[model samples]
Structures are given as structure tokens and as C-alpha cells.
Target: MISRRLGSIAIGLALLGGTGANALLAPSAEADATTSRTYESLKNGSFEADAGWSSFAQGAGTEAAVSDLRASHGQRSLRIVDSSSSSAVGWASNAIRVDPGKQYTATALSYVASGHAPLLYLKFYDSAGRELDSTATSASTQRGEWRAFPAVSAWAPDGATHAQVVIYSLSNRTGTFFVDAVDLAPGANASLTANQYFHVQNDGSATPWGWYELDDARQAGSVVPDPTDAANGVLAIRPHVSTGDEWSGAVGTRFSASEAARYSLSMKALRQRGTPVMHAALRYYDRHGEVIGTDRSGIDVVPGRWQESSLTSLAPSGTVEAELIIGCTGTVRCDTLVDDVTVTPHWDTTFYAAPSALGSADGSTPESAADYRDDAFWQEVDAALETGTARVVLTDGQYDVATDDDALHLRGIGSDDHRLLVSGESRFGVVLTQRADLTTYVVQVRDVVNLTVENIHLTADGTYVTPSAFLITEDPTAGERTEGIIVRGISLTDMPGVKYSGVGVAGTVPSGPGVVDVVVDDGLFARGGSGAGYHHVYATRGATTVRVSESVLQDSAGTYVKLRDNVGDWVIEDNIFVSSGTWINNVQFIQWALYNTTEPGNEFFSPGPYRIAGNVFEAQEGWCAPQCRVMTLTARGYNPVDHDGVEWDHLLDPVKREILMDESEGNIETRRAVVRQNFNLALDDAHGISVTDNEYRNIDTLMTLWNTSDYGAPSQGGNGVYDLSNLFATYRDGL
Candidate 1:
């Protein structure tokens, strides 16, 4: 007798003769037309029967058999016990026929009771039964816990028609392991999403359902009944630690995860005893089982109280597996209880905005585009940014942005794991313009990360001199600093005037942290108010890893780039810094006043290893009348004479000057920098700069240090500029 099954329906064939001869059978036309064909290539994959598998033991004291002792799934598993220290032992599945040039993935669940981990492999064979190639996962070493083999995928080699699923113990191990629920299917496996939320049952068993000791060899613990609910249970862990390592006592569950996808984890934790802190966290691993990133929940678990902790994270690049870990830190003796763990993925959404669209106002599509003037539309955007991902798409039109506060207040939004993007239909078509004269910035972003603003034009009323076109600041309640900000393909301009034009794009170190990882690329920052306070790109203090490249910084009332105090690891390259008639003073293109401040808590200043290369500095003829310098580097008291004859309202008086010059240095020394491979066109001499490998056109005396008699030189080892070899690569490496 023979049997054939196609998708849940089976057909049986029986011979009418008594001789037991072979016979040909065909399906009826009606049956063939209505049914589809499928194949279960790997027979008895669940290890319910031992018929489709072959086992072997090549060394002394090795054993392999189908056992009902323990299993990851179903009621039975293939058990392999190895006491042999020099030979391999395990089971191999019957050959599963495969097509050449097609990819396949083999997945299985394994539980190691005591010993080294077993390795899973997919071995391919050619048409002649010769072995071709194989792919294997590293030994998964989370002992006494059930773990999925890191998925192994391979393409069938040329002339190959079959493959085998192999589970074997390494040559030098002495332990017992079980393999169950093995599968071999075409294509790679999908990320697991079904068993995200787990609840303990009445019998004190969880998913993959087993009660065992904690993974750490020294830790002694188990699954116990929940104190609050007698019907349910919780994972109870007690750390056995000789050191106070954060991961000293941890239990983890691994799942398949996609790279760059966002996930959130939440669980209820209770600290019962000891002085250690209890935490719920996640660790991401790559294909080779190396940990790539770890994110810990910020909520603290207090003793005797069940507190829920939540965390959101983005899987790093190249991540293949993610582990949810509950652990105790800071002490050797601690008891922690965890229950009701949930993991969720945050999906992405796209929003549309236009001038006249009004269908439902959901921002889901062009027909349902959000009205730009609707406060509810912006509110919805802000809400999406907090929890998940959002992309704002704007149509080509003028947007009237007139408000007393910032027009767009991106406050307490986004995170390092998820980013927000605002983009226009075209680079120069969408305009964000101020309708009324306001003193604040057009767009103010406070304590946001991974935000990108691009492909728009930002401007103010011709009469209103706003403080800044775009500003970045910190809100301590949200984060420590604003980071991962990008301003690309934008045109930002301040009100035009010599006396009081504001900055184009500015970052201020208010009372908290400053900005970092800021990139201004392929943009225009121009038309600023004159004086020492206004600039195209300005940072008062604490601007770390700020880069300005492939942009135009032109027609500034003050210097183009001004960085003061505690700035380092900066790059200014591939830019055009041109001074027009609006630039009246003899201001330089770049200014670095590396000064220290006594702002109570923030004091230290770092002498940066800086890089200024591959830029062009040009000035219009007869412009910058008094003098023109390419760049300036100085400390606070070094240029006191520049303020010697200042009038009232100069922001600095003689008494304040004396106090500033008399302040303590705090014993911080400045590090010199390199300015290389630049082009200076018709500009006056430079001060305190080491110009190297630069080209000059109609400019005399390009390399000039500050004179002590004429301009008050910087103190030795203080904000002095010089050239060094291979500085760009060095500074980039440090960043």
C-alpha cells in the first residue's frame, strides 16, 4: 500500500491482486483540477517518530536516542549524550530533495541540560552523492535554557539536488542535549512575532515550557508561583556573584529579529531582597553570535513592589537575533521576580501635508493630505514621533509660519532608535516663511535625536529680524543632549541688516547639554546681522562632532562659523565661504574662541583636535574694509584690546573685561589644529593659523601668527593654531 497527501487531504492506493505487485495509479480529472500539490520534504521533523532519522556515536560513552525525558516542542525529542572527550556524536536526518540554485533555511529548537552547546548544520550534496558544502551555526552557549539555533541559510550548490539536517556535539564536550521541532524550508525564516507576550501558567511553565536552573553556572534559582496570584507563576532569579557586574545574574529568551527594525519591551519586575538593582534589558546579536548592542530600561525596580519597566530600541545593523534579558546588578546577593513580559514592533508610517488637501485630514495620502495650518495636524505628528516612526511629506507651496513662540516646536521628540524626517516635494519649491515679525526662531528643536530636515526654504519677513532661522537647544527633562541632527539641502536666511540681523542656524548651550553629531550639508546659510554675536553657523559652547561640508556660507554680517568653548572633533570642508558687501568689518571666515566659563556646573574646555580642509575663502573687492582674515583662533583674555574702546551697549564694559581676563584658567591646555589644502582668493592676511598646502591668488602673507605687541597673542599652550600631518583621519577616528 502507498499513500500521498496534498495539503491536509490524503489519497490511499491498494492493489487488488494478492501477489503484492507494483501498480500505477492516477488522480481523477476532477481531483487534479481542484487540488494543489505540496511536499513535506523532511519527514517526522518533530521527532515524534525515529523512522526518518539516523543516529550514531563514534566515541566511548556516547549515546543518541529518541527520548521522552525533555522537549522544546511536542512530547519527544532526539537526545544526544556525550561523555567522550575526543569523538563526535549525534543524529542526521534523511536526505531532503532540493532544487539547485535555490536558497533554503534550516531552523530548530535545542535545550542543553549540562555541557557545551551543540552545533546545527545544513550539508549539501551533488548529483553524484558527493558532499558539496555546508553552513553551520556557532555553539549556542546559554546552558540549561531552550534556545533557537541562530538560523542557518545556504544556497544549493551547482549540480546539487539534496541536503541533510545535522545536529552534532563538538569533539571535546561532555554533556547532554536535546533537539526538537526541526524544520527545513525554502527561503530564510521570518522574524518571530506570535509569542511576544508570555504569561506563566498554573503549573509554573512558560513558553518553550520548562522549569530549570538559571543559566549562570554559579547562580541558583528557578520558576516559582506568583505571590500575588496563586494560579499564575513568575521567573524568580537569585544571583550568585563574586563581582558586581551588571550582567552577573541574567536570564534571557532569544527571538528572530530584523535589522534596523524598532522594538519595545515591557515587563513587571519586583526586587525582593539585597542591595542590587533589578533591570529588564535587551541584547542584539549578529550572525556569528557576537553581541552588537545592548539597551537597558531606564525604570528602576524597587524592593517589595512590582513595577513595570519599558524600553524602546532599534536593532543595530547586521542583527540576526535579539535577546530579552532580566537581570540583577550591583551586588552578589539579590532576588528578582519578573513576569508578564511583552515585546512589540513599532511599524513605520508616512504622512502628507499640502495647502488645500482636506480629505479626512489623516495625512495618510495625497487625497487625505493634512492642512498645513491645522494645529491638530502638527499635534498628530508630534504624537506619532513619541511612540513610533513618522515621515512628513510636504507639497510645494508657501507655508505661513507666524507665532510668538517657535513656529515648529519639535520638543521632546524622537530617540536614537527611531528617527523623524520632514521633506518637501522639491528642493526649492516649498517655502516656510514668517508672516509676522517674531523675536523667536522659525523652528526650534529641543532635545531631539535622529531628526532630519531637508529640501525646503526658510525665511523671515524683510522687516522682522528674528533671533535665528533654526535653533537647537536642550531640555533636561527629555535627554542629556540633542544628537543625530541633519540639515541638508536647505536654504536659511536671516533678516538683512548690519546692526541686528540674527543667526542663520545656531546651537546654544543654555543651562544644560549642547548639541552633538550635527551635520549641515549642501545648504545655504547667509544674510545675517552684523557684529560679533551673529554668524551663519554659531555655537556658544559644547558643540562636539559638528560637521559643515558641501555648503555655501555667504554674506554674513559677522563671521561665517563661530565656535566658542569646549568644541572638538569638528570638520569644515568642501565649502565656499564668500563675503559680500554686507560683511562690513574685517571678519574672518572661521572663528574659534576656545574659552572657559564659570557657569556653576559646566566649566571644562577641550582643546580640539580639529580639521579645516578643502574650502574656499573669497572676499569681494573693497569689502571687509578694515581688514580681512581667513580664520581666527584666540582665547578669552588674549584679545582684550579689541574691546578697549567699545561704546555703551557693546555687551562688554571695562569692568567685565577685567573680570573675564582675571578668571582662573582651570589648568586646561589647548591642542593645536591643522588647516590644510585650502584656497584663499583676494583675502587679507590670516592670524594665528598654520596654513599648509594651500593655494593663494592675489593675497600676500597668508601665514601669519598673532603678534603680542599689536593684537595681544594667545598664551602659550592656549588656543594656538598649527599644522599637523594626518590630522583629518586621526580626528575622525576619535569621533
Candidate 2:
């Protein structure tokens, strides 16, 4: 049976029956004292099965089975009609049977009615039957409609039994295809809170009763569950948004609440027109998902009118649980439509809290530790985060935060494994010799809302100056600051061990309609973060949607993540940017700017389109500074006054000297980028970027000035060059 179910979960995963059948399919012991368990085994997942499933087609197609047509939930579907335009495997399925090594996950709810399936397998077989490992997902996981495909794994290797799903259909557009519901489980940990406890459901989380959907086919074009349609039952989902696509749409439900001050939600949106918008937001997370705040429901969604929209967000000051979201955007097709939803609580407990910060009663522990982190532990954590869902637990020591009050308040209370730590008197760490720079900030996260700071390790000899050491943006006297901040697995070392500057995480831009979403993952930003010449992780003016992933921005000295006069939405991926030391260009540790600072739309350089993927750069050829030009976008008159009379804020930076005190009023060059795949690199002085498929081992300069100079040198201009596909493995001097 698929090699006795891959002999039990792929004995070490290599195409199938993994890890000796997942250690002989371990789970027993009454399913580990049960807290959650679901082997699933397809009950027709959500298509509500009729024929359980048994389709086949092999080489050219004509048709297959199970079809009630349109469905991502409830109704029924599994159609496949490859009228053979040529190549084909069309469709195949004979599913069920997996446990060996136990780690399973296979899901499908795809939707693309006519033509499409440039490959969509999911195989597994063994036991005199060979083919033990397989997983494919093509057409870049499009979203013309129904979505939810991204999860495919197969470790049932050794003598692995059987499980299948084909559907290749090479061309002829691939012909008509549509699969629905289809899940094989066993692998719970979906963040257990007693498992699927979603509420406010009128059918919102359709699919099979549980809930999950996080679209991003290059930015929302589909989310699913709308199988066809519904406003309150039977089914409903589809959070698309376009402008062609950009971080796409959203559909949420994560639950848990507290730390209130406006967090209502009501949903039922609509849109075919009316400018496109379907929002009813609420993000606020923690326990490492970060995002401490995001609120909407300022209601929008008009056209086709289903109305009922109602939002209220603004829940910082220690928010508890969150994730409501239903966002959608605009421009391209828009289609926005969300359904029946309601949420309310925090009827104003007069900002309730305090009683050992509300400990016990199930927020698990915290009856009193006294050293909660200090400043009265944030005043009983801002009064137990003002009611409902609150928790605090950290035990190890070294916390000396005497609270200079950067406003991470807290107390709104919670219990989903929240934590806080500062650690012993720089014990040999923060040396100013213990008076430790009296606290300008080794950590300061303003406003607050679902903050998550995991696995900390601090160090700051940032020699009293740049509030280095993990300090995120905006506190302009509170006014709606901070937004879901998260700095994971940190390690800031100093005295050259690796590095740590005063700007491990310091973003500015937050005054005038706020926006912030900092996610510095897998952290380790060595060489004095944000201190020496600044930028291990820095942001200015537009700090919206900043996501520095799989981190490791070494020897910082001249930009490593600097966004000035910012706008937002940047995703610098799988990093490892190491340059011995040199700045003023070339190894320009990620920098983006328009007029340097001053956000609120229009004036050009509007935030992003940046998506510098899979990195591992070593853009050598050092000796930065003077006449600098390895990487720089100094438009708006590239000479804000060359060193002459140098007070120009050392060459402008108060938002570019306020756009150079209104340099004849004009600026907005909208930055854009998408430098792909990596390994060794040098994408210098790159403007309006776009360079695909890379493999630049090390210098000779890959691309130096794509958008060439500014012509007049003021905002965007002439051939800043765009478009350049499949960058035939590089070793270059020009584009």
C-alpha cells in the first residue's frame, strides 16, 4: 500500500515515504494525550463528496470525473477536460493512505475554469509501485478565481503506499480545469488554541468548517471560498485586489482580543466599481507574527452594493489577539467582495486591569514576578493591557529597562505565549560600564499593538549616540504610532564579534497618517547596527510594509536596509549581504527614496515595487565615499549643494532638508525594483530597477546605472531603464 504508506511517512523524505514512515507513524499514546488530532483522509474535503474520487486520463485528455462545476467549497468539483491540444497527463487521482513518518500536508481548491494547468501534480507511490515523491504547482499559482494551493509535501517514501493527483495538460491553454476541496491531513499544530475556534462566521471561512487563506500571487487577485456566491451562508470568499497585483488581497480570522480602544468589525462588502476597496481590517498579532496594529472599517466598498461595512481598528496600547482582516485593494479589476461578519467586545471596561496585571484566571502564570521588565513593569503592563487576553512571562534575568518611555506600554493583557525580556546589567555586555548609556534605548517600540520579540540577545556599546539597539519608528507624541513590530531570533553582538549598531531596527517616517510593518526575520545584523555611518536596518518617512527576511546583513557601515523619505512595501529576501566595509555606493545595503522624506502620497517617489529576491551578495571593489557611485539614487538635484557651506544638514536629511526647502516645488520619482535570484552580486547605482535570473559570483559590476542620471536631476526621468528579462547568468559591466 504505497510501500506500507512509505513504510510510514517517507523515511527521511527524498521524493516519498519519508523518515521510516514518520518513525513508524508515531502518534498513538491515545494520540499524545489529545489536544488536537486530525488525520483528515479526504471526505471530499469540502466539495462534499459524491463519488469519493477516482478520476483518470493519462497522456492526452478528453475528460475526467466529479464535477458539479464551480466550487472551492460545498457544491462539488474535480473536472478536467484536456481536449488534447498536444502534451497531456490531463488528470489522475486514486488518493488516501499516508502515515509513515506522519508529517503530511496536501491541499487543493484551485479554480481556473477554461485553460490552465501547466502542470499540477501531487504524486506518491511505492511498494512494487515506484514513483515515491512528487509535488508540483504551476502557472505561478494563478488566481483568476478560486485560490488556496500553496502547500504540498510528500515524505511517505520507504515502501510508501499510494496517493495521487496529476493534471499536466501542457498547452492548448491546458483546456478546462477545476479541482475543489482535497486535503489529506495529520500534522496539526495549526497554532492550536483548541484548534479551529473561529467565530463571526456566517460562512466566511467556508471550505470545510476550519479556516485558512492567505493569498499573494504576486499580490492578491484571488482568495477563494466564494465557490460561486453568498453573503451570509452556503459559502463566500474572494478577497482580490489589483493594480495588476501587489501583495494582493487578504482574508483572515485568527481571534483572541484585549488592549482595546476601538476594535469593532462588521463585514459585507461589494464592488464591481466605485473605485474598488473592500476593507474591514484588524491585524494586530504577536507571539512572533508581529504586526501589532492595523485597523480599518472606515468603510468603503460601494458599487453592486451589499453594504454593511463597518470598521474601527486603532487597537494599540497592548492589544491582545488579532487578525480579522478582509482587505482588498484597487485599480485593475478590483472585484472586491467580502461577506457577513461581526465582531465586538471591549465595551470599554473603563480600561480595566491591574490585579497582579490580571494574571491567573488562565492567562497562565504571572501572579507576580515583580521584575516583569520594569517601569512598574510598564505599570502593571499598562493596566493588564486593559482587559481580556493578556500574559507576561520571562525568566532568565538581566532586565534593566528603567523606562525612558518609548511607549510599548502593555497590559491590555493576553496569554497566547507572549513574552518580554531585557536581561542583566549589560553584565559585560552594554558597557558604558553599567550606567549603560542611561537608556536612550537599547529597545524602544512606540505606540504598540501585538509586539513580538523572540529569542533576544542584546549588546550595545553604541557609545551613547544613535539610539541603536532595536528601536522601531514613530512616537510623535503617541499619535497612532507603531504597527505590528516583530524582530525574531535576535543577536546583536558588538565589539566586532559580528556587530550591533544603535540602529539594529530604527525606522523614522511616522507622522502624518502612519504606516509601519517591520518584520526583521532570522536576525543577526553584525558590525555595530545603525551606528557607524548607520543602517543595519533603518527606515525614514514611509515605513510601511518593510519586511527584511531570512536575515544576516553583515558588517554594516553604509546601508544594509535604509529607506529614506520613504513610502513603503519592500521585501528584501533570503539575505546574506557581506561587504567588508565601504559605503557611498556599490554595496548600498538596500536604500530607496524619493525626496528622501515627506510622505502622504503625491510628490512622486511613492513607496515601492521592490522585491529583491534570494540574495547572497558580496559586491566587492571597496573604498566607498568620495565622489561615491556604486549605488545611489540621488535625484532631486543630485547636488543638494556639494559640501560647500556644509550645514545643509551635512548634505540634507531632515526629510532631505524638507525637499531642499521647497527646491522650486516638485518631486516624486516612484522607486521600482525586482532584482531576481542570486549568488554573489553587484547591482550598483540602479534606478527604476528590473533584472532577472541572476548568478553574479562577484564584482565586475552587474548593473551600475539602469535609470541613468536624472537628466535635469530632479525626480524620475528619461530611460531610467525598465524591463530586462531572463538575465542570462551574469558577469557584467553594464545592462
lDDT of every predicted structure (CA atoms): 0.56, 0.43
**Sequence-dependent TM-score of model 2:** 0.30
Candidate that would win on lDDT: 1
User: Residue-wise lDDT of candidate 1 within 347-425, one digit each (tens)?
Assistant: 5767888865668878888778987656677677767766666678888777767675426666666655556777886
Model 1 scores worst on lDDT over the 10 consecutive residues at 15-24
Residue-by-residue lDDT tens digits, candidate 2, 566-626: 3455667655455544322435555554341222222123324555654444444333443
Q: What is the TM-score of each candidate against the true structure?
A: 0.43, 0.30
What is the Å distance of residue 643 in model 1 from its true position?
A: 28
Residue 728, candidate 1: C-alpha displacement in angstroms? 14
